[model samples]
Target: MIHAHLTEFHGLPVRYVDQEAGLTASQVAWRVQGDSYEEDEGTFADTFEQLLEWDDCDEVRALVVGTWGWAHNDDRADVPVRLLVEAAPRLPALEAIFLGDYVSEESEISWIGQADVTPLLTAYPRLKRLDVRGGDGLGLRPVVHTALETLRFESGGLPAAVVRAIGASSLPALRHLELWLGDEQYQGDSGPDDWAAILAGGGLPALTHLGLQDSVRQDDVAAAVATAPIVARLESLDLSMGVLTDAGAEALLSGQPLTHLKRLNLRHHYLSEEMAANVADGLRGVEVDLSDRQDPEDDWRYIEVSE
Candidate 1:
């Protein structure tokens, strides 16, 4: 007998992909448009409730929902957001939730509320990964304490309160953290100091790997990295594709107490030879990445000390 796997995109409908016995897994992609689906907005709540009654649905392995746009418009009768929230109770098997361009647009703020998030998060106690990009200004305080192993906050600004909540909540299972700042409408300026304060207060204690991309300020990045005592526990750190400078590198090396960091990336930065040497000297055992520099092939040589 051939086994089939079912996956849903934007909670529209489930698409089944045929799977062979023990070989590689097959990949399938499905896209839904408003014209193709006949269900109006008012019927969404019921439709979603019925869909959630699937016997095979023990947990949601992955959920990708629209945050804003036509799906979230107040005038639209068939809002997928409402159905997604309502369907949350049925997605006990959900392990990962991906919020796509739904949250990225500027017009869908009215439909995206804190209440909508509560049901889904409350329902998926086993949720491991949360990837949210854009939407109404949803505060992070409510969901930061979830049992997530990998947390990616992209293109949105995180407020201080939300930052504090993540620190206070001991996320023991968390291993990977990715912060992509400055992509959407943010409430506060995510300066390095703000991030520093967040780490000093203990945001991600169990993080073993971290990635930061598209940060605006270098000093803030430096300050924030310097403040993270948890870096000492990290095995890999990626700071590629950002506005990080030599000062940031120096701050991370000299200020931050990263004793266990084995791999460090400093790609696409403004690091001088001296700063590179300083970093090489500070992180003696760690492998440093200096790719994407003006002088890519240049070797980093640390200063010699004679007694």
Candidate 2:
């Protein structure tokens, strides 16, 4: 049966309305409420343990936990959070876990702040994707080594060190890496060279597609792409929203023979029709895109290459 709680409903009994009906594939949604419950500490611990020990618990495909309200300054909820983390190891068949703000109104405490979700990621092992936004400073560096295929960092400000760390690590199974740098503070200057070096050092060899949105410079973007040894293997290169000019694009496409590059996105730039035509002519097999900028009406004209 599906389970949903409108308040902080941990330690409550699982109400099976029809015991003999049997449980089908179900989803559980919990909402945290700011009400006090009777203190049955020992029973609560036992119940949590029982859930962890259940062998058939692997049938659970998805789990959603929502938190609302704030814990009193003197009242600590670390123990329960630790138990939740420990119980995560029992979910051997879970595919996805989403942690974010679902309610329209903001709560006094962050849901992630109350739960130890990072430990759960390490323990779960089979988790393929994780989406997290707006937490109490959860460190992603610790769990970057997971067998995750798709990882997205949205509304969170990642430091240059963290970005560099991801670039340095080995992620063979990783295919898609999306980093969204929303309005948050960054201290150090992490330019394109650092990103280029990271990609060159084998950070993302298996990555066939990459998207950079907001706060990325054109030269840095070009340098990063040009430096990557695997650029030749990429099927698509998207640099739609950056400071790319004719010079940057020329620098990127000049030396390399991007035979596999099928789609090139150079939108939102000041490239002229003549320059765009030149870039298009250079890549014989690729489709050049210079849309929504200065040169949108240029029909691609190619010159015959001499034998």
**Highest TM-score: which candidate?**
1
lDDT of 2 by residue, 1-307 (tens): 0122333212222232122134532333221122223343233345444444445665545543333223323223344446556667566666555454334233322222433345655766676665543334434443445576655543323345445655766666666665433223332234664465445637566776664433335555665676577676677776654445676777777757765787777666556667777777887688877775643244531111000
Prediction 1 global C-alpha lDDT: 0.51
Error of 1 at 257 (Å): 4.9
Worst 10 residues of 2 by lDDT: 298-307
Instruction: Provide the clash count, candidate 2.
Output: 4
> On residues 1-307, what C-alpha lDDT tens digit does candidate 1 reach at each position?
0012224432333332122123211111221112223434324234344435545444335544432234344333225545655566665656766554333233332333322344444556777876554323444544445477887654434444444444555566788877655422343245554465435536566788886554545446666677676666778877755566676776787685665778887766667778878887877888888776644244532111000
Q: Model 2, stretches more than 4 Å misplaced?
A: 1-57, 62-84, 101-120, 134-138, 142-146, 181-189, 201-205, 266-281, 287-307
TM-score of each: 0.65, 0.59
Per-residue lDDT, model 2, residue 184, is 30
